[model samples]
Target chain A: MSIIIDEKTKLAVSGLTGREGSFHGLRNKAYGTDLVAGVTPGKGGQDVEGTPVFDTIKEAVDEAGANTSMIFVPARFAAPAINEAIDSGVETVIAITEGIPVLDMLATYWKAKEAGVRLIGPNCPGVLSPGKANVGIIPDSFFDPGPIGVVSKSGTLTYQIGNELKQAGTGNSSIVGIGGDPIVGSDFIDILKLYEADPDTELIVMVGEIGGDAEERAAEFIAAEITKPVVAYIAGFTAPPGKQMGHAGAIISGSSGTAQAKKDALEAKGVRVGESPTETAAIAVETLRG
Target chain B: MDLLEYQGKQLFAKHGIAVPSGEVADNVDDAIAAAERIGYPCAIKAQVLIGGRGKAGGVKIAKDVDEARQYASDIIGMDITGPHGEGPFRVDSVWIEGGSDIAEEYYASIILDRGEKKLLAMVSAQGGMDIEAVASANPADLTKVHIDPTKPFDAAAARSIVESAGLAEDALDEAADVLAKLAEVAREEDATLIEVNPLIVTADRNVVALDAKVTIDGNSLFRHEDLAEIADTVDDPQEQMAKEKGLTYVKLDGNVGILANGAGLCMSTLDVVAQAGGAPANFLDAGGGSKAEAIVNALEVIKSDSKVTAILFNIFGGITRCDEIAKGIVTASGQIDLDLPLVVRLDGTNFEEGLAILAEANLPNLHQEKTMLDAARRVVELAGGAS
Candidate 1:
């Protein structure tokens, strides 16, 4: 069984009438995901790429049997869309919209937690369960069902690291791109817990970068609880201190959020921190093979 | 982006946070005049974006017009270097504000906590000093509380945090009020960090924010038009150009010009180059779905750094088509004449198509690598990184 979503998962995409929403919404269907419904306030009863649209998330859930939600709403409307998904009783919500305000995310996160909803991202490429299911925008073409579980803090890095693993003949159980914002729904530990519990995932590859203490905290959790062999790669080792590299979350403030600090933390927990993506994949492949 | 002190104060004032009456002046005469209007015994502060202005002799208390003129003259052209060598921050303007009798100083801030995934409200009764210094010396002096991510920011929580920090009974209510309002500013203004280093309890029993440090989140700028208007100010030429082109570009000190599709990958690309024994010239994210024009624009920016001996394009196409990036590279090759070598590595959807497009062009000095490591090694070698 895959984590997050699977073949039985039914999806309702909010903002399905918009440009990026329609584009990736169609792509999700083409990948054979159970794209059952769409949500657009004024454009209800319309269709995007043959998916039936509803005026609200509640309607999408009630009428179309949608159990999962993918929100492609713009940043300005993202918080409300996330709230709608949680309130509508969807078990899992993935926010694909980038540029959401941290404060807005905070409010939505509290509501989601109270409702016992699993929220993936507000600035991420969502989740891909290899051939079984695809949610959000992580390209399914790069994935194949296997034993490795891939989780990353950045979307492009997920693709990059996923490609490296695939080339090494190790397919993934599931892949989660957790987004590149200062505040996001899920962190490293959240996915790590899911991967640790999954029978299909024999090993894990955690891709993190400079910024935040998520990776450091993950390392601590991994040491205490995770029995699976995990390899990690953190970006921005050469990045200067006290500057934002690219991602809103990828920054080094003082001595706290440096790549070196993260690498050291992971290493202290018996996790191999690769100097490069290629090296990280090699370690995972080696560990599995041995 | 980090706002200047005066700009931060303006934002504070806009949010109903009490600040001393002040005006920014670009010249000594204007500073003196502004000080005269604000009343005597005022503070003349350099409007440098970098911190440590007080330590750099960029700040002085002036009791009269002569002192204001003298302080303004000394501060206007002062060069301040912040810790970790951030500056040589040149002072171009000065803020002359009415002075206050500080009965007590407190520190307060609201910021997004990455690890907790919540808004953090931190307050300390020990103020009139750098928070970092306070953190190192007496960590217990700073009281931090978390605000819920899925609910409106809790002013009550901030108030309690400030109250617990052990303020004088007379100053407690106003200090708590200031902390609460600061949390609101963090919510309403879409700020990543709002810091008041010296939230003063004045001699006359008034709570006034004597210093403000605000960092508005660039990602949330679209919703807050007012914050958007105050962003960046086009301080650096390349930065302004990148802003217009929608590229995430940060100039750095190195020679291997690097470009990648996403932020994480972009940063990883820089690290990989360094690992391969080469320094990156700049951090450039071509962004998702980047076309030929975007590549050309990025190349132009990289070209401005003459230290760049080679370039590397690390694209892992998801929503971003590799073939589009290939065409972009080809188009860029034709439009811009580059003497330096470039190594392109493409993977994911349409990767073969992307490779075919690049092979068709076979531009001069262009190399293709099958793996990221090979690509990095190739560019670094060409960059004179190989031993």
Candidate 2:
């Protein structure tokens, strides 16, 4: 009953011959995801521990029936890899690579949208549907199938919340890391919509940070559409204005993208917003119990 | 990644976009010489990244050599605080340009619109005024067009945008040409923002960019080697050190030094520290899969800040294993004479082993917490309480 990915999710690994690609791709395969294909141009026919490698996403889709792609190519080539995934008719593309130029994402995103393909990240930890399947680098040890659905911009923060919830004797339906870039393929509202329609996901945990009006906009959408109880956490409350705090999208530009502003927006929409990751998990736990 | 006005103009000129004729001068004498060469009644503008230089008295019109010398001297050393209260940034250089005969003023820019997932072209006939204000006051005056980056924004497309924004008919053709060039600059130069605030029309009906506000995408800077050189160097010593060490660090006004593995966790660590009655001295993301060396480097950078009395390491292991982070902490304790109180919180992958490693090392100054909240509380208390 998990959203986005499940036991039937056939996966392809882009840049599979590379270091990160092989590491996580093999790991995901070990975790029982249907690892059907590998994509690394010029490395065709080369297999990573028995997984078939192809030169292009099209071959992977055609020969191996790969519906989803996990991209670990370098930033310079990540965008093209994403576009190739879309063009190949893969239903979903998850890019684990960081630092792809914004302009590249703009074009790839437009293409993905037009083609009706779901693209996950450029600088994210990827998604995991516990016990059934794991994609990207989200630790396999963190969860068991349960009622809560998690979506976040921050990878580590998502892990922290998942750990906290697990400690409270709860588990997750799915954990989606939408990435921490200014222009990501998927955003908070996009995942929230999925969670709302999922039968297994009773409550949602959203983790957001400063910069951009995404969270504020998500709050508006949640108020209108999401009937599921949502517990949220926003980072960078103490951040100074005009300073970029680690993530490209995490910055307080003037007074617009402050954590306080985001918190207020979410709270006004009846979403329980936590001051910290631990508190966020507690709120989600309490909501589920209710 | 924000370029100064002169640098932006240089980029614009390189992309075939029209900008006022100018020379950059670092001192008064060169400014006067450059002004004389350009002709009298030129503008001496401060070359600072922050906006509102004109309001800050960082810009002046010089009629002759004496005026040029006076204006240049006044602006070169002037400190301009931005309209947004960004900075009192010191002006190190001045861009002296031949004054334009402004028959009409319009606004044009090409920027990445995150919500739209497209390049947004905003044009307005009401230029020389704040675009935000224009959008709010007279929304129709601000013509907003979302251009797909996959498709070309040629002269024809640009002309339609200019005409729709209600630019003067005579200036439309020339403005469209400049807009098209600006669009090329946005695409080719990998500029996240290319703003010509007052795209001016001269008496001769020539379209010229009076100002350029260009922000090149920092991630794409690797491809743009020449443009990368124009990036503002980190002024903070600790920040510069972190940059060299390949650690993501930002200096903040606080005393409790913070370190975490991910950007979100790092920011949350800061917020938790503040909530726990502590002010975080800085934000440092050790990044995923951090090794012992990165731990030592981050510790050294934090200790270098005399304001830091306590440091917290919040690691929620995903790809970043806790044992590796634990080894890093133990190694950092031995390498640096860390007199400040250190609090470490390890969770997720291999956390028990990581905790066992930290406990075995038994560093006297180090304290281990079971959770991020508890860690923040302990660090704040050890750092002498509420900031």
Candidate 3:
């Protein structure tokens, strides 16, 4: 079985009437995800191409049997949307909005934890279980059902590796984008645990970048708990200290979060860290073959 | 954004935290005048974002009018290099504050703990030194408490932290009060970091913040309009230009210019370029909307950098269509006086249509590669040798 999402997952779109929401929500529906409902506070009873739209997540859950939520609300309203999903009894909430405040995320994260709900992202591409369900914004064309489980902080980097794996005649069991913010709902360990538990996931590909101790911490967790062979790609090896390299969480602060330190940590744990995306894909393929 | 010392103090005072009275002066005369108004034996501190101002002689104590004038003049135009050798940032202003007689020095700060998903409050008796150094050298001297944002942070909680940090008994109550107020500033002002490096207990046993290092959350600045006004401006011309164009760009020291559709992709592109024996000049994320105009703007920003000899476009079309990116590249080539060789690698989501658009245009300076690795190597080769 796939991790996090599968054919039985029923989805609801949180900001289904908006531009990005409608665009990606409809696309996910077209890709055969069980996109059963939509939530847009004042736009209740409106239909997004036959998917029932409700005023709240509770209505979507009650009326349309939505088990999961894909939130495309604006940054300011994104956290509240996640909380509403948790309160409404949705099992999982995937936030695709960017620029969410860290404080708001902290509160939402605690709430989700207490409620036993899985939260995916605040500034991420979301999760894709190939040929089964497409929950967030990961491009549907780059994936297929296979042995590798992909977990990354970068959306495009995830897609790049997915494409590389597909071109090499391999595929992904699930591709989870945990987001690029300083405070996200899920971290590397959270997804790694799921991948390791999934029967279909034979190998794991982790794409990490600079900033934060998440990668270093994940290294320790992998060394202790993970028995699956993990191939990783960490960006920003040549990045200068103190400069925020695109992503909010991708910065080499002082000497702590340098790419070299992350690479070293992962390598010490027996995880093969690639210098580039293509090379990482090759290493994963080789590991699977071996 | 990191606030200047005076700005941090102002934010602290607004939140009921005690800070020494200070005035910000952009000129030497105003600094001297402010020092006189505040009384003698005032501290004239350089108002630059970087640290180590005191070590660079950017900080001085003035007892008399003559000394105030001399110190202000010395600091006003001083070029202090950043601790990381980043810059010789010129000090444009001085913060003159009334001096206080210190009884003891301690440290207190509130920062986001990503791992724990809580607001981390650290209090240490070993103050007036780098907190990292303190944590590394004497780990027990620093006491860290994680506060759940969902829960209330009260005076008793602050007092417990202060007491646990091993501050002197006399300074405990006042220090606790300061810590409580500091936490308020962190929560209310959306500050990612609120650090009082030397939270001092004065000779009269009053706790006051001697130095304030506050960094407001950039994402939350929309709610804090006043704080947004004081946000730091980009110093590099290329960075400022990229900001104006609404592109996520970071200026790096290299020759091959790199542009891509997402932050991760841009960073990975930089890594790939480096692996291919080329140094990336900058990291530019054109983002999801890689329209023709956005492409022109991104190309202009990358081309403006003199070090860039070649440009690489690594686009993995997810939400962004490769055809749109191709149109952008073709349109950008025509819009600007294109001189550098551009290696375009387009994949996924209508990539063939995108490649066809570029091939139909057949721009002489443009080259196409099917794979990211091939494209990176091609651009690096054209940009001379690797770093």
Candidate 4:
């Protein structure tokens, strides 16, 4: 079966009255996600493009039977919004807001873990299951809904790889942008575990940049648990240590979290690591063909 | 953001952590005045953010006004070469404080350990030396405790930490209190790291934080307005331009300017360019949702760098439309005299339309490559050939 966001997932959009919420809500609806309800603090009676708006996530869940939350709140309110979504008993919560504070995400991440709520991102493009449902901002046009399960930290890089794979006649079962923050809701290991468990995902493609030890930890998990064919690509190989890249988490500190280190870790575990996105796609294709 | 020693001490003092009476001064006259006010036998330390200021002779002790003036003038303008090959900061200011008598030194810090998903509070009796040196030489000298996000780093825990690190019993209580205060300051200020190197124990049995270093969590800066006072905007003109445009840009010491939409792609572009026998002049990420305006701004920033002999634009449009980026590039070239060779690579959404928009420009210095590798090679060859 497909992992995370898929068919039969009822969606609820948070911050529905706001500009970003209204914009992406309609886009997701147009992409054929089960657009059930929306949430705004005070404008409960209002509707954004026929999607019902409620004051809180609890009310939206009660009225619309929504099981998943797509939070598009501003950066300052993102952590609290995720807390509300998790407390409301939603199965999954996907946050699309960027510029969220690292400490704020740390607290919110702890809360999500305690509640056992599966979370996607706080600074991400969200998740997409191709034609079935697009939860985040991933363009549905580049996807055709097939066997490759793609996960990435950067939104545009994910899109770049998606385009390359599509050109190679490869389609994805689900594509997840876990976020590009120092402290994100999910990690490479989390998505790898899910993809390993999913029957429909034949190959796992991981897109990572230099930052924390998430990729190295994922390599350990892939070696120990994941049986799926994995092709990994890490960026920031030439990045100077401590130079802040575009992504908040994309920096090399001292000798740790270098692209070379990550590549070595993954390769030592028998995982194919690619030098570039184009090469990574070919590796995935070759592995699947085998 | 790494706060300087004076700023960190001021923050520590705000939390009631005992710090030596000190004042930050930009000029030697102010520094001498501060030293006179703090009384004779004071310390004059260069207010550079980089480490090894002590080793580089940026730190000195002055017993009189003449010495203070001499030390301040000597340290303020001097460049501080760091131990990690980080920086040779041209000192702009100095922090003058009352010097301590014969005393012992210790180290204490609270850091967010990402791997363990916890807050790591570390302390070492071997303070004057680098903590990395201590951890490698005598791991037992450094005592560390992990605190949960849900729990507070209290005095009792701090006491155990300092005591275990072999702190003398007479100075243990106050040191624990200082540790707790440091932890509180770190938490309240939303700091990723709060460190007090050489947490000094004076001859009077008082526990004082001699030098402080704090890194505020950049992500959470939106909520903490007070910390913004310490945050310095990029001083480099090109980086300052990108910062103003809300684009992530880093200036480098190379010849080829690189631009891309995402951080990963931007970094990959930098790597590929270097691999193809050319050095990137800068790292500029236009971001995912950047439109034509951002593109113009990015181009202007790259063009401002005179070292850039060639420009390469690698746009992998997902949320960013290649066509929109093309319009930005074309419009920017119209705005500025971009008299450098260029290569453009477009993929994903609207590449054909993006190519068509660029095709209309007919810029003689421009070339196109469909693959990232070919584009890197083309730009490098053009840049190297021109050179």
> Which residues of candidate 3, in runs, are more than 4 Å off?
B84-88, B385-387
Per-residue lDDT for B1-387 in model 1, tens only?
Answer: 778888888888887889998999999889988998998899999988676789889889998888988999999988998765775767889998988999899988888887776778888989898889898899899988887554554445555676788877887767777777887787788888888889898889898999988888877788777778877476667777787887888877788999999988888888888878888888999988888899999988888777788899998888889999989888888888977898899987789999999898878888999878889889998888532
Q: Is candidate 1 or candidate 4 better by TM-score?
A: 4
Kindly list the per-residue Cα lDDT of model 3 for residues B1-387, writing each as its tens digit: 788899999998888888899899999889988988999899999998777788899989999999999999999988998676756778999999998899899999998887788889999999987778889988999999998676688888899999999999989988888988888988898887888989999999899999998878788988998887785366689988988898888888889998999998888888888888999999899997578788999999999999999999999998889999999888887789888999999998899999999999999999999889999999999999644
Residue pairs clashing, model 1 = A106-B149, A106-B150, A107-B149, A107-B150, A107-B151, A108-B150, A110-B150
| lDDT value for model 3 | 0.90
For residues B230-286, what per-residue lDDT tens digits would candidate 2 score against the true structure? 653766789989988999988887899999999999999999899988889999999
lDDT of all predictions, in order shown?
0.86, 0.90, 0.90, 0.86
Where does model 2 exceed 4 Å of error?
B385-387
In candidate 4, what are the lDDT values of residues A1-290, reduced to their tens digit?
A: 67788778899999878876887888888988898999989999998877889999998888899999999988888888999999998899999998887777888889999999999987899999987899978877887778999999988777878877888888898999998788888899999889988988999999988988999999999999998889999898878776788788887667789999999999999999888888898898888888
Q: On residues A1-290, what C-alpha lDDT tens digit does candidate 2 reach at each position?
A: 99888999999999889988999998999999999998988989889899989999999999999999999999988888899899998899999998999888888888888899999998999999998898899996878789999999999999888988998999999999999998999999999999999999999999999998899999999999999999999999988877888788886666788999999999999999998888889889988998
lDDT (tens digit, per residue) of candidate 4 on B74-164: 9888887667666556899899988887488999999887777677889888898788888988899899988868976688878888899
Candidates in order, interface RMSD in Å: 1.6, 1.1, 1.2, 1.3
Residue B242 alpha-carbon offset, candidate 3, angstroms:
2.0
| Candidate 1: tens digits of C-alpha lDDT, residues A7-93 | 988999998888988888888888889999999998887988678999999999999999999999987888899998999989999
* DockQ winner between candidates 3 and 4: 3
lDDT value, residue B38 of candidate 3: 98
Ranking by DockQ: 2, 3, 1, 4
Q: What C-alpha lDDT does candidate 4 achieve relative to the native structure?
A: 0.86
